[model samples]
Structures are given as C-alpha cells and as structure tokens.
Target chain A: MTEALLHVDAIETFYGPIQAIRGVSLEVAPHQIVTVLGANGAGKTTVLRTVSGILDPEAGKVVFEGKDIAHMAPDQVMRMGICHVPEGREVFPFLTVRENLMMGSYTRRDSDGIAKDLALCFRYFPRLEERQHQRAGLLSGGEQQMLAISRALMGKPKLLLLDEPSLGLSPILVQQIFEIIRRINQEQGVAILLVEQNAHIALKTADYGYVLEVGRIVAEDHCATLLGRDDIKEFYLGQKEAGVRGQRRWKKRRLWN
Target chain B: MEDAARLLQLVVNGAAAGCIYGLIALGFVLIYKATEMVNFAQGDIMMLGGFVAYSAIAHWGVNYWVGGLIAIAATAAFGYALDAIVLRRVIGQPQFAVVMLTLGLGFIFRAAAGITWGYDSVGFDTPFTNKTVKLGGLILGDDNLSIIAGTVLLCGVLYLFFAKTRLGVAMQASSQNQLAAYYMGIPVRNVFSMIWAISAGVAAVAGILLSPVSMIDVNMGFLGIKAFAAAVIGGFGSIPGSVIGGVFVGIVEQLAGYYLPAGFQEVTSNIVLLGMLFIRPQGLFAERMGKRV
Candidate 1:
C-alpha cells in the first residue's frame, strides 16, 4: 500500500522474564484506520507498548515514517510523532484538564500552532472546554476518555495508537466514542491503529482488520470481508437470535443460499 | 520596656536563624519534589558547599562573592556527579536502600570534609563586616538584615524560575507523574539531575550566607535535622511553606529559650515540630489529594 505510516515487523517484547508479545507483525498505512481485534491477554496492549517504545522488543523492527525506532526510548519515539493513549486512560489525576492537554504538547515549541490546536480540541469536545479548569481526575468515565483523545490530538501525532478506548464505557457511550473516532480519522488525516476486544464495533470502524489470538494474528483481511466471514461469525460475531454456535453456522450458510 | 526590646532582639535573631533553616528546608523540598528522595545528606552537602567556598577564598585568592559563586557551581556539579554515579543505580529499587545510601553519602561527605578541612570549625567572612542599624531605640545587625534580604531574594528567584519557565513546568510534570512525563517526551532523568544540582546549589547559597553568622563545621550538618523539621512544618512539597516553616521553627525556639527554663531551651524547637506533626500533619500549604470521586 501507500507507504505505511507505521510498520511493525515480527517484534517480540519481554517483561522481565515473561515474553508478552512473540514476533507480532502489523502495519498501519497513512490516514488509514487499522484495528487489531483480539480477546483479553492476546498481547494487544504489549504490541502498542512495544511500538511506542515503552518496552523495548527483544528482536525485529518498528519503522515509523521510514525511521528505525525499534529500541528508542518512549520520549524519543513520541518526538517522532507517535502518540500512544495507553490503557486505563492514565491522565494526570492532580493536573487540571487544561494542564493535562498542555502536557501533551510538551515536546513541541510552536506556541501559536499549539493554541490553535487546543481551540480545535475544544471544538471537537465542547465538554472539555466547559471543564477546562477542572482536574482531569474528576471527569466522568466517558469524559475522561474524550479528554485522553483530545490530549493525544494535542500532540499532533502522525500515528495514534489507542488501547481499548471502549473498555469501561456503556454501549451508548461506546457508540458515541466510535463516532468520534470516525470523525477524528476523517478530519485529522491522522493514521489510527486501534487495539480492541470489542471486535464488532472495531470491524465496523476499521478499514482493515487483524484477528489476534494468543499473541498471533490468525487472520487479516478487509474489514467488510472479515465481518462477512463464516469463521468470524462462529468465533466473534455469533448471532444472539440463533442462541447456538452450530445453528448459527448452518443458518449463515443457508441464508447465503 | 527592656524585656520587650530583648524579646524583639530575640525575634530578629530567630528570624535570621529561621532564614537559614528555611534555606535548608527549601533545599530539601526542591529535591524531594523532583525525586521524592529526602536527600538526608543535605546538611552535609551544605557544609560541603561552605568548605568549597572556604577553600576557594583562602587558596585561590578569590573574592568572597566569587568564591560563593564558584562553590555553588562546584557543589552543583558534585550533586550531579553523585546522582549519575550513586543515585541512578539504586533508583526504581527499594526506597529504603536509596534512603540509607544517601544517609551513608552524608557521612562520607562529612568525613571527606573533615579530612580536608581538619576537625576544627572555620569562619566564613562576609563582604560586609558586623554593622548595625538603629530604629526606634532598637538595633539590627547588617548580617541579620542581609540574611533576611538574601533569603527573600533567593525565594523570589526560585518562585519565578518554577512559575515562568518551560523546564520548570517539565520538572513539575515529572514530579507529578514520572511515567506519563516520560511517555510525553519529557526527559525525566535530566529533570532529576537538574533538581539534585539545584538543591545542592541552594544548600551552597545557604552555607555561604550562614558562614558569616556562624562558624562552618562538620557538626553543622546536624542542622539538617532541624531543617527536616522545617520541611515538615512547611508541607514538604511546598516551597513557600518551607520558608515559613523554617522561620516559624526558628522563632519558636528562640522564644522558648528566652521564656522557659535554661535546660529546656535547646530542644524547645523540637516540641513545636512535634506539635505540628500531631496537629496539622500536611503542614499549612500542602494540597491534599483525596480519593477521586
């Protein structure tokens, strides 16, 4: 494809003695929304951590913007325009929401451009503007998620790595979040590599998808094809109405006929 | 009227002494805020700073101010070197080990100073000799007045440094959340190193300032115990609190020494320190973070 913004080639990461990610290879093209769909403990978070340079990989390469940033420190990687919105939304609890957003642009020197982006963030999430002076820790769960995204946007990254943005949100809020993600993708021209356990929603939003199971990509295809596949239906998209796995498989085949 | 004048004199002396305590407390707060390590060796470091200035003035034939500047720079470099060599290795390990290591460092620094300067205390002469100002039939020494003025100037400069600069904000961010700061591209290690140097530099300034009032000795390192009390009084992380706490501690001690029995005077300050710990706990100005609702 059209010059991958982030290229991950067979990267393995270890936490002390335990190998969390084993030769995981992935890629996100410029301005594309790519989702890594997996269950919990499938090494999705580890992959993001490795690519973002929080944890160094034992082997393989992470090329961002054609630079080999495989073993670079997190700060150096962030300087190269890869912003990772980590799991649990680790927003600074003591800092004001405005201060948290300001911290996101810590590496940047363009004051005027940063101010403009901040205004754009307030436009994107008006709720943030209302609570601009409030401590980030006090924001509601959904609002905190919005603030995290807005803070990441403040970094003005070429690539955004999000780990389970829908983790603790209600269905309604999840839908709202997905819509905001869609807007961010379409408007910002920023590439997104989303790692999520919510496969149904992830497939709907992503242009391309990779199905991860036990630290390996079991399948990779266009999101529409993945959504349409019989195997995916059996494993992830089993219909609630069918109430039985085998029956749904037979029903899906019969429906096509 | 004579008793009131004596009391006034004690208060002024106490304030001057409190400025020194405040400077010591400020050093503790700076390093503690940046790294969460107490730097128990701070008093020894201050003593070391004084010795550096003493050597510079005596051997190098430097002016007292120039010697003071050189001493601050040298001690700052020493602090940075200590961080790089000793402190960096023990970081992310058991905090007790780090604490004990710093305590050991203090002893080592004191022992080194003792070897170099000998066991005897030495005078650190001020640029201004003992002069007096009279006001309403009361007298104020130039040294005491300068001590107050100097303390205010240092505090003001530090306040502006932390408030107006980008590096200061980055240091603040690092202190708040080291991991988040690192992830955000802030060089947290550099910030820690800078903080250690700054703390040492502040200690050097205190040492140089106090050298005029009191003779410099290895025993002066014990004054860190009192400064630690000052840090507690000010609310450990608060800069202004450190200064106020130091002054408060100094004044209380002076008043107790004057009013109470002769034997109780020496440890009277620790009683106020104990009261502060039991009553307020967080000091006057520290922000308490409750559970996030």
Candidate 2:
C-alpha cells in the first residue's frame, strides 16, 4: 500500500474524563480515498481531530509521511502537509473569499506556487472566482463547502482530512461535491481521509471504508465488497422491506429464548 | 462673531482631546479583537507610558524624540510580557476571570507608577510647548496641531498595516477565528502577543502626546474609563468605530463642560454610553454577528 501515507495506529483520545476514541486505528494509502463511516456520536470526528493534532491522543502514534506528529501543534501539523477541513465549514466569515483562500497558503513562502494553486482552486470551483471579492459569510452552504475544500487544497497538502463535508447539503449538491472530491484525488494525487455519516454516498465515493461503532471499528473492507454485504445493505443502505422488521423481531425473540 | 469663534476654538480643543481618547480606545479594540479580553490595564498602560517618557525626559535629560522612542519601545515590551507571562495562562478560562485579572493588573500598574514616580503631577516638557500658530483671528497651539496630525498619521499607518501587510492580514484573520487560523498554519499565540505589543505602543504614543497637555501622574489612568466608554460606544469590536466614538465623546464632553452645570464633564461619556446602549447596542459599525451552521 505504498507504505501508507498516514498511519493512525491504536490511538485512544479523550475529552476530559470521557474517552471519545478508544484504541481506534486506521490508515490511508497514497492517492487513495478512505472513508470512516459511522452514526452520529460514534467518534468519527474525534479520530480525524486526533490525526490532525487538534486533539491529543492518550495512547499510540499518528505517523504522517514517516514522522510522529501526534504531539505537534495544529499549525506545526499543518506545516508538515496535513490540512484539516473542520466540521461545519468554519470559513473566515469576515474575510473576502480571495483573502480566505490566500490564508490557506499562509505557511508557504513560494509565491509562484501559491499563485498557481490559487488559480487551480478557482478552476476547481468557478463559483469562488465569480464571488472572490464578496465576504465569505455571504456564500451559500454548497458554495461554502466548495470554498472550504478549495481552501484546503490551496495548502497543497499531502493528506487532506475532511470531517462531514456532505452534512446538511442537498442530495444533488452532495453528488456534485463527491464528484469533485474524486477528481481532486485522481488529478492532484492527494490522499484523503474522509469522515462522514452519509454511509451510502461515502462508500460509493471511497476506495476503502471503515465502520465505526461506539468509538471502535467493527468492520473494515474494500468499498465494493463492503457495499455488497447483507448487513450493510439492510442497516446502512436502508433496504428493509415492509415485512422485514417483523421477521427480524421474531428471529431476535427466538434467539433470546 | 465672538460666539462663533469660541465655538470653533472649543471644537478644535475637543478634537485634539478626542484624538487622544481615540488612540487609547484603539488599544482596547486591538486587544479585545485579538483575545476577547477587555484590558482594564489599557489606561494604566497609557499612564505608565507617560511616566516612562517623563522620567526619560525630565529625570534622565534625554532628547524629547529619543525619550519618546524609548517610552514606546519599553511600553511595548511590557505589554508583550504581560500577555506572554500572565494573560496567556488565563486563556480558555472564564471571561469574568480574565476581566478581573486585567482590573487587578491595572491597579498594580497605577500603584507601581506611583511608587516609582511619586503621586505628584509633574510638568511634561515637549518641543511644541508654548508654540502657537495664528490663522486670522484664531490661534492654534503647536501641541494641539501636532496631536491632530499625529492621530491622522497614526490612523493612516494602522489602516495601511491592516490592509496592505501580510502579517497584519494574518493577525486580522486570527482575530476573527483563532482555531480556524491555527488550522490554516497561522501561529495564533504569537499573533496575540504581537497585538498586545502594538496596542501598548499605540497607548504609549497617546500618553506621550497627552502628558504635555495634562500633567503626567498616576491619576491619568482614569482616562481609561472614557476610552472604554468610547470603545463600547463604537461597538466593541470595530477599529474605526473607536475613533468615531472617541471623537463623539470628546465633542459632547466639551459642549457639556461649557454649557451645562458643574461636574457634567465627568458624567458626559457615561451618559452618551448609556444612551448608545439603549438606542443602538450595536455600535455604529458593528460587525455582523452571523451564526455558523
């Protein structure tokens, strides 16, 4: 797997006394799209936060590009080529769209490279170019998400960590965003670790998938194989027929007896 | 003709004083914008700057220009230290705790200044002292003109700093969202300290300008309350609002002192502040507070 671009090995992270991620481990290979699928409150966001240095894991190491970055600050982590697109698209509302995109390249000194990336970003999301002078706060949800993704791309990151990019978006918009995500991975060769609750779309878009339940991974498989599983089809794909619930209830009752 | 001349003279005087208030309020707005802390010590920092410059000029017999530079550098260092050593520790704590800490620090600065320089008001010597420029029937003091020119120049430099410079833009981005700024590879903590240093340096300039007009003493810290009122009136977060608020407060105080009953000068700012709070709680240029989904 090309020595794995990001190796999050057996990391346990806590928020004060409550442990949010318990011995969770995952990896993303170079030029691959990896998705962590889970229900809400299943600690998917916690894993991404830990990997990106926003939260310190109590145990284990996060090796990125062959360096232990678990103890680094967020800015330091970013300098090492990891960019986190946080949950809820936390774009700088007061800054103009162009300024916000410029801020993404804050750590870099190569002006030519930055300018090139800026043009690339605008190309990826033409809406950003049309409203480059407008305040970011004025952008619609779909546009803001596009801006958020493009901003991360401006950093020229080796691995991008995206938390719930599809949340609260229309289905058509979600499809469009996923298409862009795939294009970014194929064209730019940037590794992506996507955390999402939209299991169906995530599995469809990703090459590999991990199923997180209650802070631990219960399933890991290639996206195509995982999509074909009966349990995944019934639970995550919402394929329950009209009589299926009753049949499953009777089957569970018999097992219990 | 005489009444019109008096009113013009009063307006000029008020504008000079308003410029000083605006300078001090700029410090408050800068610190608040960066750290979300109301630095009660802002006024005392000005007093400290005034005293420092006075000591350099009056006691050490340094050149006025040299003394002013020294005071600015010293005050900026002190401010940077305060944030790095003290305020940095209180980050993520309750807002009330940070406010009280600043209030206590203000008192400490006042007491320290009193101990070092004594409580007596001392004359502040400047090159502009006693120099007046005459234009027809009206006379303008060099000190007042200098204050006005200095305020305009300082504000212009600050505007360019925020609008044109890379570091300044990064600082503005950090002020807007620290976590997001950090995610963008901005050193947020260093930006906070830099904001403190700049605020202190500005406050020091205001103090040095003010001392020749009003004698340098520990009681000079009381001007902070007026500046605070200006910040509140301007909408706490806005920079230009601070200057406008300061000018508004200054004009109102001058008018109140001239036409109203005794002691009206003391309550004028508070009165305007209260009116502002009641009429438009969001300062004139309040940044739109949008909820992030």
Candidate 3:
C-alpha cells in the first residue's frame, strides 16, 4: 500500500529487563484492517502498546501519518487521533455509560460534533443506549466489550489500536463485533491494528496479517494468502490430515533462511 | 423546658461544627480518590487559607466576600503547585513516603504560618459575629447556622459540577481508570493536579466559613485529626457520607460534653471512630472494589 497510516519500523520493547518485541516492523495503510495473530505471550499486545505509546519501545520508530511518535505520552498520541482500546474492556465502573462515552470526546471542544458521534455510537451498539444511565460495572461482559469499542469510536480516531477484541466472547458475538468493526473502518475510514489469539476469525476479518512467535515476526502476508498456507491450516485452523491431530511439531524454518 | 431548649441549641451548634469537619473531610476524600495519597497537610492548607483571608480582609481592607474568594483561589493554586512541583515526582513511590512527606509539609506550613501571621490567635468581625437567630423558642448562633447553609450550598454546586460538567466527569474517569482516560485523550496528570486544587479550594472554603466561630491560629490545623475520623465514618471515598459522618461526630460530641464528664467530650470522636472500625471498617459509603484483572 502507498503511504501507510501507521508504520512500525523494527520496534524493540521490554518489560523491566525482559524484551517483549524484538525487531518487529509492520504497517497499516489508511482504512485498512491489519491483524497480528499470535498465541499467549507472543508479544501481540506489546506491539499494540508500543504503537499507542503505553509501552515505549527501547529502539525503532513508530511513525503515524508520517510523524514519528515513539516514546510520546499516551494522551498526546490519543490527541493526534490514535485511540487505544486496551484488553479487558477497562470501562469506568463508577461512571454511567453516557458519562463514559462523554469521556471519549474530552479532547474535543465541538459539542455538536460530539453529540453527533454519541448518536453514531448508540446506533452501532443499541444495548449501550439502553443502559446509558446505569453504572458501567453493571453491564454484562458482552455489553462492556461493545461499550469499549463504541467509546473508542467516539474519539474520532484516525488509527485505532485494538488488543484482543474477540477475547472472552461467544462466536456469534465476536462475529457481530467484527462486522461492526469492518463497517466502522469502511464508513468512517478509521484504520485498525487489531491483535488477537483467535486466528481462525482474525484472518477472515483483516486485510493483511502478521504472525508473531515469541517476540519476533515469523510470517507476514495478505489475509487470504495466510489462510491458505500449509502451516496456518494445520496449526491455526485445526485442519489436520488423518492421524495428525494433537501432534505439535515444527518443520524447519524456510522463509527467513 | 429550659433543658430541652438547651439541647436543641446544642444540636444546631453541633451540626454547624459537623459541617466544618465534613468540608475538611471532603478535601481528603477528593485527593484520596484521585491520587490515592492522603494529604496530612490538608488541615494546614485550611489554616493557611484562613490566614490569607485574614490578611486580605484586615490589611488590604477588602470586603469579606472578595477576601474569601481570593483565599480560595490562592490556596487552590498552591495545591496545584504542590502536586506539580513535588508530589507528581512521587507518583510511583510507596504510600508511606507520601505520608511522611505530607506530614513534614504540615510542620513546615505551621512554622511558616506562625512566622507570617504570628502565634497569637486572631479574629475578625463579620455580620454573623455575636448574632443569634431565634427559631421556635430555641436560640442559635448565626455563625454556626451560616456554616451549615454554606456547606449545603457548596455541596449542591459541587454535585452539579461533578455530574453535569465535562471536566468533572473527566476527573472521575481519570480516578477510575488512568489508562483508559489517557486513551480518551485526557491529560491524567493535569487532571490530578486539578483535583488537588479543588480539594485545597474546598479546604479554604471551610476555613473561611469557620473564621467567625473560631480563632485563626497556627495550631488550628490540629482539627484535621478530627476530619480523619469524619472521613473514615463516612466511608472514606463517598461525598455525602463524609458530611453525614461529620454531623454524627459533632452531635455526639456535643451531647457527651453536656451530659457526661468534661474529658469525655474530647474523646467522643475517637471512641466513635474506633467503634466504627470494629463494627464496619469500610465506613458508611465505601465503594470497595478489587481491580478487574
């Protein structure tokens, strides 16, 4: 893609002393859905955090809209139109749903635009509107997830960093959420860098995909191409041949060598 | 009939005293809710506010109303600077260090105030001074009544600010989830400083309202100890609960002072505090919650 919206150039991040993301580079073109597929502790969330400025990379650049934003404060990155919806749907439990949504537009002063966006969020998640006055802590897990997405949308972000959107949801709910995410990207032109462990669905929803294995990128391809790869089908999709089920073995690395 | 009238007078006076404690407790609650640091200097801040108002009114010859407002604004700015210049650096420090820092700050404030305002207890005359209002055969000091009325009015304004205004909601969001608030483009550090300013401003208001009833002295900040009791009784984090707890302590103290021995009144609040801890340590309106994951 020409002129990417978010470009991560070999970022290396660490938690205390242990390196989490080592020499990982990727890009998301404007309005494109980019997914990072990995197992637990594969540094998927670390990549997203690095982009959103929650965890500053020890090295390399995170360039957004042609501006280098590595090591910037999270609020500054957010003000530059990059909103991050962290994992676990961290809603303000003490605040009502409406108040939580109001926080999304805290950086903006245009009341009319905020009100319109509020309406747009309610349109996407009707359940949120129904519980607008209730405390956010009272909402169900599914509803909280919906509220988290809608809250991010209210910020009118140019790039959205979403960590594990399909986490802890039924397959049907995941499908519904992903459908709205796709529509949001299509209609509002909000670029997304989604991180997920649910590889079966992540590939179907994203346009481009990156496979991470223990702090490094092992595979990168178009979503359709990644789906057809022999390794992906056998390991990620559980499409094993007869008598090969439940066996965990790796063929020698080929692409990098 | 005389005893009943005396009791009624005592109750009204107790309520007024309770309101002062409530306002001071509010300062503690606001700062604690936002930054999780207990400002042991909260009462000293109020003392400083009172001295400032006294200077503005007495030396500058300003009106009572204007001087009170100036004191509140000045104290609020001081609170903001206190956080920005010093407390912000200790964001990740252990809680015990903050307590020690604030405790040290309180001693410094007292010494500073003593140097500037002198060790003598000072007073200024107000419209409420030496005045009494009669209600149904019960006589009450106008000074005490004004404190109650002012607290109610201030609480109303604060409630509207927190519930209706965008900045107020932003403050709540920052206190609830700092990370999520940052994602929403909130300057969480600035928001925290603002919370400290509000807490200081509230303390200043309490000090000014208290000026007519009590003398403004360097040692007056010791009242903060009682406010701690009020906050604990109120459930430490809740707003309305703090005020209610203050009132309870005030009334009980008044009753104990009149009916029981002289020394018993002084220890009434402490007794109640210990009793509440034994019975329900969470306070009256605590929002006890464990962080989600």
Q: Is the docking of candidate 1 incorrect, acceptable, medium or high quality?
A: medium
Cα lDDT of model 1 by residue, B1-293, tens digit:
98888889899989988999899999899888777787899999999999999899877889988998999999999888888777888777777987899899999988998999988988756765587898876798888888889999999888888755778767777887777777778878888998888889999888888887888998788888889898898999889999999999888888888888887756866887889889998897786774232
Q: Judged by TM-score, which candidate is best?
A: 3
User: What TM value does the first chain of each candidate achieve?
Assistant: 0.93, 0.94, 0.96
DockQ of each: 0.54, 0.67, 0.85
Model 3 CA lDDT for position B98 = 96
Top candidate (DockQ): 3
| TM value for model 3 | 0.98
* Candidate order by decreasing TM-score: 3, 2, 1
Summing lDDT over every window of 10 consecutive residues in candidate 1 chain B, give the lowest-scoring window: B284-293
* TM-score for each model: 0.91, 0.96, 0.98
Pairs that collide in candidate 2 are none
Q: How many clashes does each candidate structure show, in the order listed?
A: 0, 0, 0
Provide chain B's TM-score, model 3.
0.98
State the TM-score, rounded to 2 decimals, of chain A in model 1: 0.93
lDDT of 3 by residue, A1-257 (tens): 88999999999999999999989999999999999988899999889888888899999999998899998999999999999988999999989999999898888889999999999999999999999999998888889998999899889999988889888999899999999999999989899999988898889989999999889999999999999887777766778777666555654245423
Assess the local accuracy of residue A205 in candidate 3 as a C-alpha lDDT between 0 and 100: 89
Choose the strongest candidate by lDDT.
3
Q: Please report how far candidate 3 places residue B256 from its true position, in Å.
A: 0.9
Candidate 1 vs candidate 3: the TM-score winner is: 3
What value of lDDT does candidate 1 attain over all alpha carbons?
A: 0.86
